[model samples]
Target chain A: MTLQRPVFPLLAFIAATLMAAPLQAREALASWNDGPTRQAIVDFVARVTTTGGPDYVKPEERIAVFDNDGTLWTEQPAYTQLLFALDRVKALAPQHPEWRRKQPFKAALAGDVKALAAGGAKPLMELIATTHAGGGPEDFQALAAEWLAHAENPKFRARYDRLVYQPMLELLDYLRANGFKTYIVSGGGVEFLRAFAERAYGVPPEQIIGSSIVTKFVLVDGKPALRREAKIAFIDDKEGKPVAINAHIGRRPIAAFGNSDGDLEMLQWTTAGAGPRFGLIVHHDDAAREAAYDRASPVGRLARALDEAPQHGWVVVSMKKDWKVVFPETPKP
Target chain B: MTLQRPVFPLLAFIAATLMAAPLQAREALASWNDGPTRQAIVDFVARVTTTGGPDYVKPEERIAVFDNDGTLWTEQPAYTQLLFALDRVKALAPQHPEWRRKQPFKAALAGDVKALAAGGAKPLMELIATTHAGGGPEDFQALAAEWLAHAENPKFRARYDRLVYQPMLELLDYLRANGFKTYIVSGGGVEFLRAFAERAYGVPPEQIIGSSIVTKFVLVDGKPALRREAKIAFIDDKEGKPVAINAHIGRRPIAAFGNSDGDLEMLQWTTAGAGPRFGLIVHHDDAAREAAYDRASPVGRLARALDEAPQHGWVVVSMKKDWKVVFPETPKP
Candidate 1:
């Protein structure tokens, strides 16, 4: 089949004009307060996007990766996924009787945050594995969506998805407006993240890189289903961040953003690349609005990265000062 | 930073008008000969893209996956990657004196296809592992590009990249023009496909899902590098196609195209979904233009898929009758 030839000149002129509209009227990073942190981001984008400039990167090569949890959304008091897992344990306690007596399960069931934290990563990993498995990918997505819809953060008194940083949303929009493809690289389960990332952040499922469990293709009563297995396939944290980025993205990103040490290596690997690069860390210092434990905190700790940020030319974004407003609906501090 | 309020009415109208141009004058699947096959493709696209229609899929859900090897290009005489591996074995033969005595290596060195085939997938896998590994991803990409630039298909005497099917190229363009995201879900090495898929086929690296090797992130003299390990990570073929699709894309595709049984499950998974779906198999029956081998061929064997096409509603496209031309530059047969 062939299309009728159209009046090319008029259509071409219109497309060209419309294409230039975003460039002329870009309200970029509106939630970011006027400071070195915001300036650094704007400057880096300008340098890379300027045509014929030394640091100019092609649109195809202009890739930006963002760490999700604390970087994009809230990961206070406890990681959101951990909270989900704990809630899941309580919900499923009737089915698994041994969970009522098990250490992590017992702690989870009793809502003892201190005891759950005391057991360390092993118990947290166990909680994740048990809760995030046995269902098909679609089933898991539905389950996560259902929980996320009703679940509220105790401190914020709002749904977890509603707690996404307004500054980060603007940053994402700003980068995309400048022709940079933004991807979410998180330490959380990919299935869990996919549930709300699209609607909450505008990041698509294919653009999300996160830790995942082994998902097998099985025939369940003649229907093909991707069964999520109780085994970790990859962990997109620390050094694993760079590894997963390469495995999924196939190229080094020009810019990376994160809030914790889990994202340290990703920042290192991204900024270490030749040519113009950027790495920014979101330092959660807004205790008035959100929890602020960082360096010594078990979840989303920021010790080594905090100390090494300056050396790597990584900008540490002070959440309390740099962001005009934390959440989309939150009053400006 | 805030953008000045601009005159938006004019630009919005222009954008709306341009967006409707493709719907009005879509020159779709030009290289496809007019037949039931072309009609099926066009009809499926129309059904899914029609707004307010019962089968109308959202733009985000209009994902179309394609198998890379036989479906997109000529995998005649031998698969292109296998041929590259054999050539690499020859190129590196001087360094490895022990390969002179090794059965598979000896067979590879002698260009003994029958003997190599007799060794089954093991020797072929070993060849892939040994030849494709031992370098960082960038280095491997460079190596692959260097080889692909020089390597020629013995049958066609054309570079492998140059042998991509014209009809398939048109189909890709058609799908993209109609708001469908096209992805290459291949059994070939992801790195190998990444080397040329972007430039040659317009399919980006992230969108190219395929077999991969384990890659590690480590510091080389304090410089971060992803060290490509010589271990098979995942094979994206047969059932693995759906598995990898779910892992990478996190959703079932609306359309799938392939020329071998390796794509059966992917097609099944796509078409069996509860909506408008399309599955196409390219039957390479034009011996004068391209090689014709189906059920008995060791490489790209098409049997079960061909047998099940009728039941699954997959359109079987005969290269001789349904395609106006084969390769991009090849004259109509």
Candidate 2:
């Protein structure tokens, strides 16, 4: 008996050709199953983009908001950004005695992963407040840039940037190519994501709307500076996503993508539009190639969205079944 | 003997191709008779843009600003926006009685073109104040949009937009195609230009820096509104151009283009850079085809800059000789 492995090179070549082909090529997403899931995306993009197409949205009105963590990139085990902050905290531990006594930071500093995980959302939020807040915008930017340059993913032993999903990169390019001004509306700190979003995602700083600390423009030591205040201006998560989208973007997004119950409001807001709209959920079902957990997962629980996917006419993409490859080219163990 | 007149189509096709070609295809100004003028421009841009180019400005440091009236678009005879405002004034004349006796309004209502031009800069500024300053942001935007839809150029009978110089439009596109983020640093009200600039020019509203009337974010009739206040925020012309550029854009432009002495300070600021920069002055020298005036032209005078063209490295383009065509074709006439 002879066994045949899928030809990786030929598959990649086909994928590249399909992506590079002009928009007229319907073959790009043709492999998607013929179900309500796929139809939602195809119909929304078509109606909104097509001129004189009933749901035709003008170029100025074509705003598409996206969640960064778990949606655009892999955010399992924990968010890649949070991992980077933890590494920074560990590296700076010798200078601060306060962190040594803190619950989450002490667990992180002592190399107690289980203990840190046990601390849950409250302790994680505290860690974020210590590292991401208090610093001025410039100082926060400098710190983020430094971490981005040096931080490596513990699992891959590669730079955190190398872990970005290639498929999502193609989707971002596709949306922008289709006259949609893509924005990263996320729960991540706005200043943190802004430092590298341009170079990594091709989305400029002004286009980013995320959780942010209040900042005041002031003349400090005879020079202008935007001082970071301790107060949180907004938290762009859960129901806050819809409120932030209305306040900042000033328009409802024609398309929205997410992977968790945290994104339910955003998906609802996007689909509620009078014109064409799309809502997609990425179901993490591949435990072999990448970490996969669903309703029971503590970090990125899909819960309500997962249960409601069938009734709501949303595209639920099963990662294990759909993606031919995951995380680009990682060496087989 | 037979006389040959060039067909309009053949001439137009050649001009369009020339305008669309990449800027590098154009000849360098090195061979031009104006030596110092050419050097000033080249040096400024080079220093600010080059990596180790003496003025080696970083990406964040690359801020180039421009004046709209006379500098960017044609502001001869009367400012195009003001003409729009005057037409709006006439449309709204039936509602107001005092306008019939007012000097500028009387000049506007009586169809007295000579008297309107004779009113000069002060009366023109006052006219703008009366029409533009009292209205809130939304009120002004609606007014500008309404006026632009109906206002016709008195000379051409085409819309005022049809009167824009083809060469200037090409120049704006050319500058943006380069690394420079071009900004409109004009004395005209910011909200006025911002209303149509994004569509007319590719510049976004956030990138526009101009003179502003003070506005307060207030709840009016239980709705949030930006109310106009009778106060000047920034005047962006003459000596004020450089100050506004420094204050808002925060970096000197490596390149500057203007058609009048009103842009002298802006040209100076751009040329002051230590490396390669470019300063171009459009000389309206085609009297038969278009209005040609230089030293004594009241609207777009090029006197002081014209005198110093020999000492400064500025490229004074002769519109008649340098450009094959002045304006784009307007409906057979």
Candidate 3:
């Protein structure tokens, strides 16, 4: 009679939990291979969450920042934002007659990839300026969203959204499940990233920090809007990443994920904090599953960050060795 | 047999819900007396949250920003940040013999409020710069935390944290419970507010936006730290509020709450955005329980915002009539 009540409650609890498990339970980061990289992530999270553990960090202080382009999705061939800009320029070329002869525009109009690459940063800036400026934020967001919906990756012939690495998607979910507030700190245009980041990443709009052009809050034809200006306000790359992160987040994140040299400073800032910290870089070394060019790649050069990784104790996650799959497979009709 | 199985599950669900009711259910905005202001707040929230209502706003876009000082807590006599600065100046007097004769420091050390008031913005800036700069972020956060815990409001003799208005606390909780992401957009020092706001208001550091001084990331004896500098990076007052909001949040808030002219631009910007918006100004009109001053008060002068509130259809909250209590009651010994 004394043991019956307790045993009955325990049996009921187990039965209830089992009934709920099918719809509610999930294996976090299931796409990640069972390896050292996965172990380090899981171990760090466990250490921080353990009550009274030496490395225990409070749930509220569990901040994690991520770099978008190369880290979250494929930035190979070119950044998705850059590709959108190129498409916009081509679509609007007829409106600007002088662009028929201009170097970057000329190459862009002809879809000449080599000529555009040879022109370098200056031409890239011109392309960004022409496509991005002279509009309200809403208009820019709409254009970017429209392009992203229809744009296809050349090699995979899949929508840009589908090109996201399955492993990274799992990482974001895992971090959130562990009481971490995840943020996207990217070098891409702030407006461009805001367009789809919420839908694609499950990271909210307010959690994204990125490069921006100046904007003036004004009434356009009696409607309130933020008009984008041509002036470059901030560039969130390399040293600028740390500066932007401090200016916006105002707190040093405990964990950071990145893929290029541009993320070097962000990683350093995060890892250099007093307590336990995690830093991971996705090394694109698998050509079979995804385009793999680093060290010499113009889009996202990985040389400097790769060279410094060993000294800094940063994890270099080899996509080939650490992942069983790259992008999510398409659903059959 | 099928009917019996379904009936058992339904009974279990009802029993579970009944067990949860007492713990989960509570009155929102209970501190406010039955009035038009409370009704408006409730109605706006309900309309926005209704799935197919004309005023419905998505969960991600349901952003509400609040001013810190007079809106969330008392800023009477002096801003809380200013009070801390005065205390710091007095405390550090022994270390600096020269400060004994310096205008702001001398006035601060002497506890001569009239002299400090006469010294104007210049002296205030000097006090802020002297108290804030040169230290790393962690050290400053600790110092601020220590002071807030012990500092008492002179009039009420209550700890600074306990001086927060009960109605505002209810409103913050109510908004969050209704899927709104609340942010503190204030003109106070960002670092100072970040130190105690989280504990006091249940607002996290990342959600606080404020005026800032420049800080640089550096290696202090080979350990990385963000060292504060004596440069005003941004001032989030009047014209600066919208600019700061744009730079930090990137999206126009659906609602804004403030007490003074410093919040004029923020309210205008928020209300001007297309769709159902809410703007509120807390009229500090309770002289018996709290200080009552507007239009001419040197600290948190309410002239412009008060005048503009009516034209913008902003709700002016009469604290004396609306609030059942001014601050949280002291715990019984």
Candidate 4:
């Protein structure tokens, strides 16, 4: 219960641990091209980790938060969660035959993204409520997992999970190697993220904080289950990001990363704290390799945050120039 | 994420690690008297940890939750957090002149526990809203820390942090040492517990899940800050515990410990999961060492849970018989 921080033996211990696997440790961030952006990340980690330095932070306080959608993986064309809902609408169409005439469900069934967008948040919420609820979380997780297994990104001709940027994966490894506890602070549903984040990003379910629907404990057939409700419990976006961060993490993070304005407040809240801080925005400007819509995009819009990045000292990572690889090497069959 | 469970070299590694500190690891639960309760705990841990055994569990799934108030410390006379709120009323009485006549405030100012209880939950809620809000979490955390530093339990004549049970602390350490992530699931306000739980119990802020007030991000002096609002956001007790667990942790816990009926649903939810699970209830029957009033006690009432523990296959530890020690030895000045 003492307020005393542990001694500086930590730095030596960390150095020795990394040195034990010298080649692997040094080659971290291999997908990141040698440039200012990557160097800035490396420098920040070194600065904060250097024992007895003014910017040094103890390992316990080395918290790093990253947004999930475009920051960790692809969010272009549509959010993967939205795609999952549309697929669910199609799969469950027989159970609810009225969907053939319903505006959202009819559009969703026909794969009409345009019509679904026209209905705005109400129809989207209805889709989410109908598809994502009325079952236990484990049931929903299984559904999501099953979908993710066979679901492919049309443009990449690869599984959606495989589209996770290799550079970002390297960055996650690099930060964790330097003693950072990485957390995914996403606008996506927690249940949706938890289904694949551990295997995809090495972030565990407990470490994944996100927007969620209200869930209630129920006794179904004398067995305990968490029944997902139609109502949204919280939306972890924009200003809600910082609020959720405080509510879930308690401590302010030392680093923040995102791809859109939805993460602006999280960056602001994280960087506004005293001492060493970091904020990075991933810019999707690689059209050939992946979809590059930003400011005008309905999903993962990058506007206000892009304009204010310079003032806030946030590093804007241009995907076209910064990453040597857009995705990991596909495993051979 | 792939559903692939990691192969079990884990048991060998765990055995070697434990052997590295053979004496220390073997005597982990030193404060517990050699009895059925201690044996049950050791056996459950071993059953789940043994490689290739039917009950073997992966390290990632080894989560354990403990109820805070009476489970880990003395909630005698009153819950520590309520006592803190009462003190806050006394401290801030000068600012709120109207509180002199306000029923709850008047009762709080006079330290009239009975009068405050007589007014029921409404008065208690008013006390919480008035004294626990209108400030940033950091500011409130500072207030709680300041109070905790000076506050002492009259019965023990020791600081509140010093009143944490030695047996529970050992249990926390044992779980963590065995790759289990321990979380404090409490009905007490998250902010209040976060201020001291980390230092007192080594459970970090993020790992402490509890009831919370609504918080929003606001700019004070053009800097981001989360202002606590005067509203109850969620109550994490009974059913709420499991609901909060699924929301915050996603995965169901493998082990649960509590001292009251408030934790019954959490125990049920954890035990009902499709795996080997363990639940324990602490029976405060050692009046000579501590206070004893379970079935009828207003604070930390343990009636229903005690009656149902047997059916749920939960071990009920009699404090007088099971524990060889209560609180940890006070540090020398």
Candidate 5:
């Protein structure tokens, strides 16, 4: 039953090499561009991190929180997780009659995106509550895995998982390389996001503070089950983002990123801190490459925040103008 | 299965008040003027955290790692976890006879502390391996919980769970309140420590980086089981602390706390950071209220590092001289 011991020595060697390496040589977001937006991020990080800098922030106070949907990854057409939930509802449709008659469910099952959108946030939430609620944490996690494995974006015909933005992936890696313990302070359901976040984002489930359904630990059939409770613990969107960040992370971030007004409060909270801070908003201005919908978009609307960007000193990144590529494959578009 | 919607206005109001409340002030550790030792800890935290201060460290870089045994909680006489392992050995003894005759197991069964120590680290490790290995993660967690609920410290006659140091508890709470994400980086088995850490230390299992037996995802009797892989992933003690911290936490800690030479590497790693950092070593100098053994003690010994404390700028906290109280109740010798 004893563990074989040789693995320790190998790990030890790798760790030593990593520690001994110079921090400056590490891969970082700074490698991207010399534009004001990229420079702002680099300068802010440098000012807060440098020992003698006026805006120097201590290592303990270096909390940098990120919004997941459009901030860390692409949230286009509809939130990718919502797509998963829709697929889950389809898979579980045989068991329930209520879903067939349900407005949003019926619309979703009928492949009527227009009808589903008309149902608005309330009905969308209902769809989430149906598929995401009632199961134990593990059961929900398995369901998420099952759906993610087979689910594809209808328009692009690409696996939903493959649609994550490449630049944001590099940004996460860059932030961590600079001693920032990156956290996903998102509007997505915590459990649903957590199910595959560790693999996709490298942010462990514990570090992900997001919207959550209330869950209770109960003994079901003599086994412990973390059952989805009836109440909603926290909805991490708009004002809820800052509230959830403070409650779960227990710290104000030094930097925040978002693409829409939903993340406005979080960005304000991060910038309000004493030290140097960065707030960047990714503007979807590239219609030729990626689907460009901003001010009028039903999902991830950037209207109110877009107007307030200049006054807040937030970096409004124009997707078409600033970036050399949109998706990982730029030549195709 | 859908969650019932509750009135949102009330919840939002309550959440706002909670987030907006002023910091809960507690009695300062600095007020205790037992010696410069206590002052050192306060000074270290202040210098590192204060914005615009000479040694200011940012919130993102504020990683503080603490050793569980003899640091956060008591590990006197023998490690509380080792005792749990021994009790588990006895509980499962009826099923296995080779353990009754085995070197370390025989000594453990005989209740001979001297013989158990005489068997050295290898045998002690062997005993632990035999008892802690083989079982899946959940099984081990359940076994740990059962033992913790019932096991009492032989000398104190108090449940092992009740033996935590009150001051250290306050320290953890205070640090966490000040934006530090506290993690337990211990030599104790990861799964074993995880079973009780959340309840006892308020640290979630994912934040715990420690020695571990590798486990694999497998289907056991048609149910998915994270089966114990016969490989040691990492043994988090001494030199292993920094390595494990790097691997699991992916950040070098700004502050590190420990009581023995086993934690020296972790302390070294913490202080090696560019900006502000702190390292505190607990010196067991009390013999009247609590068992005092340091340089010569086989258990939780602080020999090598304690000898060169001043040179390394390490703060050596004398238990008897610095603290007005030792254990929660001020244990009688």
Candidate 6:
């Protein structure tokens, strides 16, 4: 410069900086702390996507499945759906006077968590059937969308939409960016999760495979509609997870992520496939930022799956240690 | 002082010619004669794909459902699957000695087409079950693939893969090229169709929704496998088509193409969706290029749907008039 080196123009410097910005800004899984879990994901994806690599998967075969509840969003303090079910029970209780005196509905109306838990599986199943069926699929979708838009997370004091893990969201985008097709394979109701999955998780309704009640296509007053029936069509959890994945996706996922025992079989099925695969467990250990009760929690119990991860060579993503942030930023009001 | 033009390099000339070749040679639905049926497809696709147009549909919502049998390939000499099923029964007759005496199995084993046809729905269902179940999903897939790869259509003297309509194949590619996600909503066995669908139709396994037998996930020698059962999981036909479309795709298709009465509800459901929709019924009137039967045919009957097409604003693709050719060219040995 002292020897008359040309001085760069300000606009030129800004343009150059802007040109270089995308390279740095392209980093994905940003919420994840620099750790083995994140590194494993990047390495696996890199190997799988690299042309002519031994582990390279065809774009069509690069399927990734994620469990919904505790895995993607919060399920502790009662599964979000269970809370919705209880609320729906109370809402319908006004019409069904006898339900007010019923065990589950009685406990649900009283807002006694312990009593609802004690009311057992029968009552809970009944609540789900009543709330989920007897209406058109569109009607159920509307009900769910309305609830999710307004429903609050009791402990977090935020809406349920705000409770989804930021890291998981980033991971989803990262996988998709790397030619991976992401699917939500959850125990949650298909129509229930389908209502908000596209907006909440960037997954399409068709890609979300979950438990479903029997639904029939009918003509209601000259209008074609799919009316949900009370009978269970499929329960996509545990063993059912892999079955649903096979039935719907028809390809074994190369990568699978989950948070509880319910996902154990899905992870196993995914990893058991020939060639390089990735299995992840989102360990909810952040008691401060979020609820933490592994191996003992009533709602998202991390039992057999957590213990088996090491043997299966799966990365356990520690929510407490590995995440810079939990939920995504709450949108400005 | 000479006025001279520069000579073009041979390679450059060749590259330019190659670039121009597609424009001059390329044509979609070439097997389709220049008619309203072909024009309707082009117009509907253009309207739906044109941005800001009243009929414009977002690429993500541009779902197209197609029937597999007579619509896409030959089904005149009995559905391709039924022939495969009959062959399987004969192959497995040794395992079940009692089948030798049973009415349907005996007929299937003896290669009595007339007897099997007269045996009714019970025998038909039994044949589907036997061929579909009693093996792992992969086993069924391998069996189906092996058969399709080797089996030739006696009348056409061509393999089933070679029997797929050239026009339909072109149509599938055109739809996909226009950002429409093409799906096979078939009455054939799920695994049966899945075997050849990818290569034959350019449709992936996940996009092929068809009749499926119940499958249970089981561990055989520490290997996770899905074992098919005799029970029906779901039938992807008739009214069931709409239900299957909703359950699997979770969206109302904008365009539906079918060849039988079984596809009526699917077409109706597709067209009734409050927007620019297309419904096409392939009326097999070409007894020369292909077998012709509609009202009187037991297989791929086109009575109710064909009669109702005009009322629903659906286009009836007259195979005789519409198709310049029926099947694809036979590959060199």
Enumerate the candidates' DockQ scores in order.
0.40, 0.06, 0.25, 0.33, 0.02, 0.19
Please state the error at residue B292 of candidate 5 in Å. 23
Give the lDDT of residue A7 in candidate 5. Answer: 35
lDDT of 2 by residue, B1-333 (tens): 011222344444444434323343123331233344444444554455445545566655455666677655667566776676577568778987999998888888876655665544555556666667665565786778666666776666766555666655655664453456777777677777777666666776656766665555444553333456656544566766765554334345777777778788778767765656667787888787667888876676779987766667778887666665566554112
Q: Report interface Cα RMSD per prediction.
A: 4.2, 23.1, 12.6, 11.3, 27.6, 20.6
TM-score of chain B of each: 0.94, 0.78, 0.89, 0.91, 0.87, 0.89
Q: Which of candidates 4 and 6 is the stronger one according to TM-score? A: 4
State the lDDT of candidate 2 residue by residue for A1-333, as single tens digits: 011222344544444333323343133443344455545565666676666677778877778887888776777567766686687678778788898787778877876654554444455555666667665565887888888787777766766666666556656765665667888888887777877777777887657777765555444553333456655555678767865565344456778888888788788767765657777888888888777887877767788988876766778887776665666564212
lDDT to native, each model: 0.84, 0.65, 0.79, 0.84, 0.69, 0.81
Off by over 4 Å in 6: A1-26, A114-125, A330-333, B1-26, B115-122, B330-333
Weakest ten-residue segment in model 2 chain A by summed lDDT: A1-10
CAPRI-style docking class of model 2 based on DockQ: incorrect
Ranking by DockQ: 1, 4, 3, 6, 2, 5
Candidate 4 deviant stretches above 4 angstroms? A1-26, A100-103, A115-123, A331-333, B1-26, B101-103, B115-125, B331-333
lDDT by residue (B230-315, candidate 5, tens digit) is: 45554677766765565344456888889998887677667765777788888877778667988777778788878756766888
**TM-scores for every predicted model:** 0.94, 0.54, 0.85, 0.92, 0.52, 0.91
- Report the poorest 10 consecutive residues by lDDT, candidate 3 chain A: A1-10
Task: Name every residue pair that clashes in candidate 3.
Answer: none
lDDT of 3 by residue, A231-251 (tens): 776677777777777777878
Docking class of 1: acceptable
List residue ranges in candidate 3 displaced over 4 A: A1-26, A50-54, A90-130, A220-223, A331-333, B1-26, B50-54, B89-127, B152-158, B331-333
Candidate 4 achieves a global lDDT of 0.84
lDDT of 2: 0.65
Candidate 2 local lDDT, residue A301: 79
Interface RMSD of 6: 20.6
Tens-digit lDDT track for model 5 on A109-136? 8866656654444556667777788876
Residue clash pairs of candidate 1: none
lDDT (0-100) at residue A311 of candidate 3? Answer: 81
